[model samples]
Target: MSTFGDLFRVHTYGESHCKSVGCIIDGCPPGLKLTEEDIQVQLSRRRPGQSDLTTARSEFDTVHLQSGTEHNVTLGTPIGLLVHNKDQRPHDYAETDLYPRPSHADYTYLAKYGIKASSGGGRASARETIGRVAAGAIAEKYLKEAAGVEIVAFVASVGKVELPFAQGEDEVLGKEFVELLRTTTREQVDKELTRCPHRETSDKIADAIRSAKSREDSLGGTIICVIRNCPLGLGEPAFDKLEAVLAHAMLSIPSTKAFEIGSGFRGTQFLGSQHNDPFVDGVDARTGQKRLRTSTNWSGGSQGGISNGEDVYFRVGFKPPATISQQQNTAKYDGSTGVLETKGRHDPCVLPRAIPIVETMAALVIMDMFLKQNARSSAASLLEPVDHLPPSMILPGKNKVVETQLVEDKVVQE
Candidate 1:
């Protein structure tokens, strides 16, 4: 579905070089503070031309809040957000119309629709993500104001140049790592071109990108995102686990090839004894109720598809941009093999541009689950005590986590 989320739905529309790209947000609460300015912060980060590491094309990407809010407040209507495409060079991609770019959506999109946008991979372009970033900015604002949740993403790897979170010979996630997660922000991440907080490693990643650019090629990397203050029991378990939805959202990004949620692949190496998130008794500040706490986060803040009140962290692997200037042998529509050289403004590495997209997609999934869980608890409360339920949904503008301390509370009270 072009739409994401059951309760907090966002239906994105338009294409890469279309006159405009936008989305319709359905089901946001009434009276929430929202404005075009709120959405622009993320669009700016996602926009190209911020530096030489990304594509050379630059557009103002100014957003027009068409409908859904008045006087800077949401009326609980379908929010309409739009961004005009001002600098589109369709001729640059005319070659793609005849011969599909290797490892790109050009072939598949044509196969599925019998026709495709002759320019820019159409919806497949990273430009299509403009609508997503816009919608996600609103989702993020709602999340922060409602639940005190903060999400941050940074470059974890650039073509095998890894950082601390992806370090080798490690204790996995230790006390020091958790401490670092608390203070990480978009600003700190932006301090470096690679968006990696580590100066030395970021330089290496930048160098790799420059080398690829020099070769008329591209490189791939991974991004690590962390969610702080996630409410307990926010996921719809079994089929729609929190991790599953998150993976779904992240993989939707262009060039995203792999996804890993806490503990990740390395956890496979650990014995059951080493991998478990052992719990302890702790009190909830809001409700004054005793709750369960985990000493470690090998579980990645989730169990059985439900959030367990730990920081939710994950990694996303992105492949290099498929459209490159180098010559390649590929078949045309009739299966005749021929050499092709692609054109257009392309990034040597997509990881830097992908950082904000990862953050936004994560927020979209989190906000979706947050609303879904709230609806469930609110419904179940008609016959049961909500105090022992997972957690109440944070009302819009509340800015405080609802009094929710469950699991242990259910055991003790029962």
Candidate 2:
């Protein structure tokens, strides 16, 4: 489906070669001081031709707020957005009519719909993500204002070139990685063309991408995203688990092939004792109140399908882009074999520009989950006090003083 979310609905429209690409963001709270520039910040990052390492397709991707805003403020209605495609060359993809490019969506889309877009990979193109990025920016703004939530993503690896922290044993959750998650910002990420924070590693990744581009080939990589200060109890149990929904969202991206949260595959090597996150006494920064926290985040800030108020982090793996300029012998729609040469601009490695898309998609998932939890908590607040219940069902320090009184009252009533 083109639409995503329950409370915060986002319906994306248009395609790669379409006149415009954008989204309609429904359920945004009113009075959010939104403007085209606010959304442009992210769109610019995801746009093509940012550097030689990316696609050569030149596009400013200038966005226009079509509706759902007045005087630069959201009206609590469905926010409509649009970004015109100025550099489109549908003729560049004319060869696709003969051959269904290998590893591409050409065959599947046609098989499912009986017809596919004739140019630029159509909805399968990265251009489709422009709408997601726009909508995510809005959700992120609301999250930042309401909960002080911060979301940051960085390229973790490119064709075996990985950050030192990710390469070391037990370092996936080490102090250095945790600190990076705590302090890394978009400015730091954009400092390098590869979007990898480490200078030396970023340079190595650049070389790897350049090597692939020289051969008309492509490289695959991974991205790590961290969501700081995410509210607790944001997951839906029995079905839409936090990590499960996150996987669904991340994997929906164009090239994303794998998704993992916290210890991920590495946890498989450890015994239960080593992987379990131990509860520890801590203080809430916002309220300076006592709270329970985990000594380790092997659960990725989610346990029992609910956020634990810890920094939530995950990694998404992207396959080498299926579209390359190289020639290949493959079967066409008619089951005929021939040499097919692909044309058009495409990233040899998508990790860099994909950073914002990853961050924004995470924002969308978090925003939707936050709203679901908010509604549940709001409804629960109106109910009678737990002063009528047992201490076992109540939080450690909350409503403790009423336990004895409630027990005595129960005995008298009996």
Candidate 3:
């Protein structure tokens, strides 16, 4: 249950107050360049104490590569990584001993395991995502080298503050929003402490976070991620669709409340005629030949549960961090009533630090799907072409997936 992925497996371990928190990556392709610093970059982004809006907990989150490398080259074996929890203060969570801490995992974890960690939230803490972020950095390196895939995520909103252009006319498919998805980089996102690329919106989000922090409360918002240059056909049909797996991966993040791809909930209001992504003729950069691409990307680069070689985008909604410093009247483990106030450093708004975590999780999902599709395509390539099927069913020539679409269109016209 602690592990994820099929071809690129990752198993995470440790807890918030544990001695260390890290992961073991199994099935990493061999002979790729890797180092502690490569992984450390993303870890530092996710670490607390980066700004006043985030948790005050001071953690360097320095990563150590324990195994599975030879002189910076992966040995095609399970990679082991570790990051010591140097600044842990277990005594800060002593309040959880009596009360369950409403909206926190204290009560349910005890009900399920019959006992819970005496300090911190244990596996439920955002600290658990450290291992995921580390493993994702490795997968992301391989994907970029092997497929030229680029994944980027940014804080799209904080409470009521959002980028005005994103919600402009024509919905998310507007020219400006599309260009933003296509061009915004991690550096641009990191320009603000809120991780929002829009300067004015970022300032507003920061102020809202400070307001909540001053009140000893927390706020929640959304994150938008884009994956470009994804290979076609990277999902399993009938189940585990590309979007489905993406939803699973995103919802697993602590406090994440919702996941939606492409047009998301906004597209629901559009009729099929308005929402459909019409196929258009385009030139492939690699081959200098005509290719089929969607005129609009409302499908988020996936169609019929498979990638369509277009930019994939999605939004994830995170709930307010459950552990706030404010006092609350709640029930204890024994069902008794009491006033419980949480201790320890906590974030008023997690959107900023959560940026890298979101990008890494997306990288992990894409890496797994890419490997699965690669195997399927490799095996299919060895088979002789089948010519008996109708033109609508059989692609006209090697990689002429558009021919099948044209034939289907003719049938509909008839």
Candidate 4:
């Protein structure tokens, strides 16, 4: 099942190079302002052929609302979104029948199903992420308006060229850090078609990609994401940890190799004292009210499978895309030795376009958790007025008042 979430469920369907691929979102609350334009914003970001570095497959990837929506609003029913395949060149893959492309799923898919789709990579293609992104955009709106949560992701590293981080002692990446990184990354992407903004480094990576393309090989890299203002008590402990859910979402994407959340592998280099986030009581700069907070966020805003009112950050690693144009040693299904060359258009590096997908998955997880928190708190209804009162009103303070009860005697006895 290509579905995620227990409360706000999203089920993705269809395959790459197919007639269409889409997602069905169940449990979307009614009366929320939703429109096809909202979904298209994120889709356009992930769509291929938008730039020179990406694949040349020009797909409009437009979203068509098939059901569960009217007048641009959700009807409390399952919302369906579809993206039709417009530019499929099936003839390019004719040779794949004889020699399955090395490093691709062609062989494994055949071994498992005893048959496979000849065009594109079938379900294994990155094209499937379009549905995830579309669903994510909607999820993002819900999370932001309902829970005051925000998610932002960018290409943090391309091969060896990494985006420079803001100078700070805090282990967690905050909104300022993310904004700075985004600015630098966008500038780089604009200057260089490869999406690596640092001129010298971008050139080097471009050279490597061009070299790999010439040799018929592919390259891989990593993306870092940050989520901020997530409310506390979102995820379930033990069985459904926040990190576990995020990992599941990321690994579902094609070519994803690894997933790591705050301090991740790097924390191993530090002592326990250095890695632990120290709890403190302080006045929030934005709200000017005392609240329970952490001076450092080495734990990535999650404690005991629930958010702790801090930033949540993670990194996803992708293996080099498998559809290298290079010819490689392989064999036919009948065991005849032959040379294999992959057909069809593919990105030498998939990190830039993958940015939106990462953001989308984060939105899905955050939105689902938000909905689950609401469902748990209110038994009668999931929709309720969001409490956006000042922190002092909700938190303990010197001026806080306590309710007192007076004892009264009843004349009538049992």
Candidate 5:
């Protein structure tokens, strides 16, 4: 379960308080323009101490490419990415060894392995997500260049405060919102420390998080992520549906408690006649071709477990961070009652930091599924004479996609 994906697989390693943390990404296509700079954009967003809303711990979090690329280009081999731990304070978590924090992974991990790392909840800490964010940035870059795919995630809610645009029904992701959601820049989200796009709600969320930090308590919230311009037919049937895989990715984030895709649970309030997406046929505005679209996207761009060329959107509910620095009644490993006061640098509201993590994870899912779908749909192009090639493979003066196949004109006479 630690490893993910079929084509663009990434295996992460290291613990929270370890000397370093990193991931090895296999199956990345050759000839991609990859560098530490490409990966750092997302890492910087996920970094701790970006603002007062997140944890104050600082590691610089500078990534160093260990392998799989030369001259800043991918080799189609395994890419090794690492970020060394610089400011780990294991002594701060020494007491956690004697008593497992309530609602934290200490007890479950110990039960599974009969032993656990004693510092910063080991691999269970949000620090473990650093590697995930790095790998995701790579996936996102490849997807963007290959298919013009765009991934965006924003803090939808902090406690009871929610962004007006992303709130309401989960299935409300539509053409109207795609443009609006796409308008939400990282700069706008960063304007307020809460990372909620709405200015008013962002302030409320910030105040709530600060209040929790003051009380030594924690707050939980939700994030809404969207995948734009995803190609059609990327998903497996039955168990591996696109929506199902998306749910799997979101729920995998630390402290995530629930997952919903398009219309989600709220759609149940409507009848079948109201919830169904009616097909609308039209001419393409860009390609000048015929196109079929759903008038409404209650299916969230997925139907029968596969994408239908619409924007895929969903929401993930994150629970309160389990590592609150407050005294609570809890049991020790010896099965005795004790007052446990967890200590360490932790985020009061995990939703803000979870945004980049969510974006990267979504990129991983889309990148993997797109590769799988491309294999099946690229057959007609094979063995055909190429008029144009990918920018990396094309000669000078060729940048557009070549669709005009070579045709032989020979007249036969009897």
Candidate 6:
């Protein structure tokens, strides 16, 4: 389903090579400050053709807000935003309409619908994600204001070249590591072929892509995302857990192959004693308040499908992009096996463009949860309190009075 969320809903539409792509946000609270500029900031980050390592198609990716706001604040009405497609070369894929691009959804789409968009991947195109990113920008703003939450993601690995982990621990990488990565120049990496920041490693990766391209093949890599300062009690239980929601959102991206959180599959190697998060009460070094904490975070800030108030972090793996410029074995429309060489403007690696998409998806998931929790809490507070005096002051439901009293007390305490 295109629509997602229980309290804050978002529906994305449009396809690659279409006139435009956009989203409609149905449940954003009124009075939140938002505008086309806020959405454009993120859209530019995900736009293709920004650098040498990404695709060659260039798009201005400017956002146009259609409705649901007055002046600059949301009006508690459905918000609509659109980004027009400025550059499209549909003719590139006209010849290959009957030949599905290897590793893409082309075959599956044809198998299901019997007809597919001849240009680009159509609805399956990464272009459709523009709407998601636009809607996510607003979601991120609300989440930050409501919960003080922040999320950051980057290219953790490209091919075999992975970021160096400090002290070989699974804890969150600090600012020093971020600075180290930030200092590495794109020119230095792009100077070689592999897009690796390291000169030596990049050369190797570049050669591989060149060779793969010649052979009609592609490559894929992993991205690491870190979420910080997320409030406790954001996620739900069971099927709607934070991790599950994040995974579902992430896997929806094109070419995603795997998902991992916290220590992820690697934690399985450790015994329960080693993998357990130990709870402890300690004074906060930053806030000076006594707080409950865990010495280690193997659960990735979630336990029992709920947020544990720690950093919510995860990794997603993407396969090599389809549409390699080389000859490949495939079936023809007549049902006979044949060879074909695909031609189109494609990226050697989707990592650079994908980084923003990962962050955008995370923002959407977290923002939706934030809105749901806030709405439930607000609704619960509006209910009238009940009092009884016969023998004992008993409400119809257990803890009903206590819950009402707690809400009242909290207001007074605030």
- Report lDDT (CA) for all predictions: 0.83, 0.86, 0.86, 0.74, 0.80, 0.73
Residue by residue across 1-414, what tens digits does model 3's lDDT show? 899999999999999999999999998999899999999999999999999999999999999999999999999999999999999999999988888888888888998999988888999999999999999999899888877788999898899988663455446456666777889999999888899997888889999999999999999999999998777677888789999999999999999999999989888877888889898888543334467888888999999888888888999999999999888988877788889889889999889999999999999998998777666555555566565566666443454222222122212221
1-414 per-residue lDDT for model 6 (tens digits): 788676778899987888999999898889999878888878887888776566789898999999999989999999999889989888888656667666777778788889887788988888988988888888888877755667777666667666653434543444444443435443443343333455554556556556655555667888777777665567777789999999999999888999998878867766788789898875433234455567777788898887766677788998888777777888876667888776678877877677668888998888888666655655755666444445245422322332322122223222
Where does model 2 exceed 4 Å of error?
A: 166-172, 397-414
Give RMSD (Å) of candidate 1 vs. truth: 5.0
lDDT of 2: 0.86
* Candidate of highest lDDT: 2
- Order of candidate numbers by lDDT, starting with the best: 2, 3, 1, 5, 4, 6
Which of candidates 5 and 6 is the stronger one according to TM-score?
A: 5
Model 5: residues >4 Å from true position, as ranges? 165-182, 283-289, 380-414
For model 6, state the Cα shift of residue 312 in Å: 0.3
Which regions of candidate 3 are displaced past 4 Å? 165-173, 285-289, 399-414
Model 4 Cα lDDT, one tens digit per residue, 1-414:
778887788888887778899999998889889888988988987889876567888888999988888888889999999999989888888888788777778889898998998878788888878878988999988776665566766565666666554345544444554454334433344456555555665677677767766666678888777787666666778878898899999999888999988767866666788778888986543334466788668788798987777778888998888777777788987899988776778887887788779988999888887776655544322334335656555334312121100000111111
TM of each candidate vs. truth: 0.91, 0.94, 0.94, 0.84, 0.88, 0.84
TM-score rank order: 2, 3, 1, 5, 4, 6
Find the number of clashing residue pairs for candidate 4: 2
Error of 5 at 224 (Å): 0.3
Write the residue-wise lDDT of candidate 2 on 1-414 in tens digits.
999899999999888998999999899989989888889999999999999899999999999998999998889988999999999899999899999999989999999999999998889999999999999999999888777789999998999998765455644456666677778999999999999997889999999999999999999999999998887778888789999899999999999999999878977777788788999999754445577889888888889877888889999999999999888989878998999999889899999999999999999999998877666655554555557767677666545322221112112121
RMSD of each: 5.0, 5.2, 4.9, 7.6, 7.2, 5.7
TM-score (C-alpha) between model 5 and the true structure: 0.88
| Lowest lDDT block of 10, candidate 3 | 405-414
Q: Between 2 and 5, whose lDDT is larger?
A: 2
